[model samples]
Target: MADRDKDSSAESRRILDRIAREADSSGSSLVSRTVKRARDHVSAADVDEKDWVDHLGTRIGRVLGLVICVGLLAWLVMFLVRGA
Candidate 1:
């Protein structure tokens, strides 16, 4: 590949590596256990890695939709208030 493409690939790999390490180090791993009220032991189940990514994507989409809706509402409200 070209030099710039190689550099971009390297950077992307580094970012992916960092994400993987963070996922490993995060306390939210599947094996973690916690006690609930009345001495109930709750264990985290093994969540599929792709499921996590899908969930993140869903959240991002929802946030983007919300922002767009809010912006449109604001513009409409301003226009009406100013009689534009």
Candidate 2:
């Protein structure tokens, strides 16, 4: 049991170290990485190629989300400017 625990701990450390090294090598800022991930998600890059309906739905959803975000931001700005 003790040996197993030590082995698991060592494995976890190695995985973390590898991940840190890869991240350093990638040299991408957190914001860029986040944007890339978001773009990929909105584009449904991971969705099945055969699922056209799902792909269309994802795109529509992303567009709606963007519209909603923009609308909310506009409303907030107006509210702040008008002192409401």
Candidate 3:
């Protein structure tokens, strides 16, 4: 029906206009733009590389700290045994 078609067309245009206004507004639009830029400009390889480097760095630091703590405990035990 012609009347039904006109009604649906008008509704769709209203929905599109509302979405356009939201995307233009300041606060939520900034987040939307940032996400769009990250999708467009940032590379998957760079993210992967940074993630790998961070993961390895955290693992290495934890291992080093544990080793140092164990060494200190061993030295303390030896000192106490020798003194006794």
Predictions in order: lDDT: 0.65, 0.89, 0.72
Worst 10 residues of 3 by lDDT: 39-48
Candidate 3 residue spans exceeding 4 A from truth? 1-50
Candidate order, TM-score descending: 2, 3, 1
Question: Residues 2-75, candidate 3, lDDT per residue (tens digit)?
Answer: 99999999999999999888777665668777887654433332234567876566556666776798999999
User: lDDT rank, highest first?
Assistant: 2, 3, 1
Per-residue C-alpha lDDT of model 1 across residues 5-82, encoded as one tens digit per residue: 999999999999988876785566544433332122112123344687765665566667767989999999999999
Backbone N/Cα/C clashes per model = 0, 0, 0
Over 4 Å off, model 2: 1-5, 8-12, 15-19, 22-26
**Candidate 3, residue 2: lDDT:** 100
- Lowest-lDDT window of 10 residues in candidate 1? 37-46
**TM-score (C-alpha) between model 1 and the true structure:** 0.39
Candidate 2's displacement at residue 31, Å, is 1.6
Question: Candidate 1 overall Cα lDDT vs. reference?
Answer: 0.65
**Cα misplacement distance, residue 30 of candidate 2 (Å):** 1.2
Q: What is the lDDT of residue 77 in candidate 1?
A: 100
